[model samples]
Target: MSSSAHSDVAPIVVSDVVKRFDKVTALDHVSLSVLRGETFGLIGPNGSGKTTLIRMLLGLGRPTSGNISVLGRKMPSRQVASRIGYMTQSSALYNELSIRENLAFFGTLYGLRGRRLKERIAATLSLVELAARADSPIQTLSGGMRQRVSLGCALIHEPELIFLDEPTVGIDPELRLAFWEYFAQLNQRGVTLVVSTHHLDEAARCNRLGLLRFGRLLAADSPDALRARSGQQDFEQAFLYFAQQAETAEAGEPTPAAEKEA
Candidate 1:
């Protein structure tokens, strides 16, 4: 669970990022940085803007304000797109295509071809435990199996940074554990990961976590650090403690700490 040392430049950096849909603010001055070779979790309930922020980082959506840079290049940089991989919350697989064919398509899109593409596709399939189903049609697979295919597609190019949005959704607990182990292997090999998930226990497995509520960040730190700061025994309790503090502050009331010392 040790992360590789980071360089001067972070893999993903967000500064005062804001996204608004008319009057609804999806992100409000959101800011954080993800280091290389670490798994950073975005933990929040639904509608907390995790997906919106991830879209901006991937250059799929522009922030209404502020900045985001990935891999030392300004975002939406097509030149560096090949070095980044994204697994969206929804399955993006082609229902009519076989797993191998889907891999081939995505690989070609990432400029992989010929022998190299074949080798990469094979490796990715094995990595996700989908090698046995390589030729199976996407429509024939179960929800979890399909998710694995989507993951394999993203890793086909061996990207340096990956963004996984709720990757463990619909996956069984045992399979989810296996996926986390695979993520550790990727991190050990110098791949950075930005994972958005609502599972608090999985969030605790990350090297660092950003806890979000109502489109605002309540805290950003190691899970253990957050637990210590909030004097809580678990990640969920720590989150609730911070969230309550945020609510009280917004109401101009004394925080829990001030109330404790008073």
Candidate 2:
């Protein structure tokens, strides 16, 4: 496809993807498409395969079965690596380095250099609200501060797509709100974000959400749509409704809602 046409396609497409490690299934027949310039949330509890799916999307791992296309390229495509950003659940930063140094280092890995690198570092620091602490060593920063720096590093290269695995985990509510604000700005700038988060409240901020459970996607739609479908105004209650429906289907019983449609 031509570059322009490719840009018009969905940034992420996972088709019947299954990931396994020996007998353990991390992902099971999952499929979803993430639209361009939208924040797509993977909403599920821990061990629900959010991280596994993100890894596959980032080309760090391949599905045992089925396929994944990122930025119009197949799984594990090096050609699209530079165009994607990933903020891991764990700390991937150098504790000994200053925040500025960490951003510069990661930016260099993305082929940023000299003047451009310096500019990005400055811009990212301000974006994450860490400009004042840019000279502080990572080890000396608080957990929330460190998280901000990690986000800066991920965004230093200004990628078209980004995958954040539980980016707000362990942070204060105030900082979490700040992070989401930064994410909103990114979306406004046409960056596609795939964020895996267990926080149901945070999931509401995304343009759309995929409710995952036991490595299976129960439903993919807007938060309001999910709530409306489940007849629950509460997000948590809505998720439970879907979970129950999935369980019923697995047991070869049709859900009441399904029976009503028949």
Cα distance off (Å), candidate 2, residue 59: 0.8
- Which residue pairs clash within candidate 1? none
TM-scores, one per candidate: 0.93, 0.94
What range of 10 consecutive residues in model 2 has the weakest lDDT sum? 253-262
Global local distance difference test of model 2: 0.88
Give me the runs in candidate 2 sitting further than 4 Å from their true place. 1-5, 253-262
114 Cα displacement, candidate 1 (Å) = 0.2
Q: What TM-score, to 2 decimals, does candidate 2 have?
A: 0.94
Model 2 C-alpha lDDT per residue in residues 1-262, reported as the tens digit of each score: 3275255689888888889989999988888899989999999998999999999898888899998988988888788888889999986899999999999899999999999999999999989988898999999999999888888888999998999999999999999999999999999999999999999989789999998888888899988888899999889999999999888877785532221100
lDDT of 1 by residue, 55-101 (tens): 88998888899888888777766767888899989879999999999
Give lDDT per model, in order: 0.87, 0.88
Candidate 1: what lDDT? 0.87
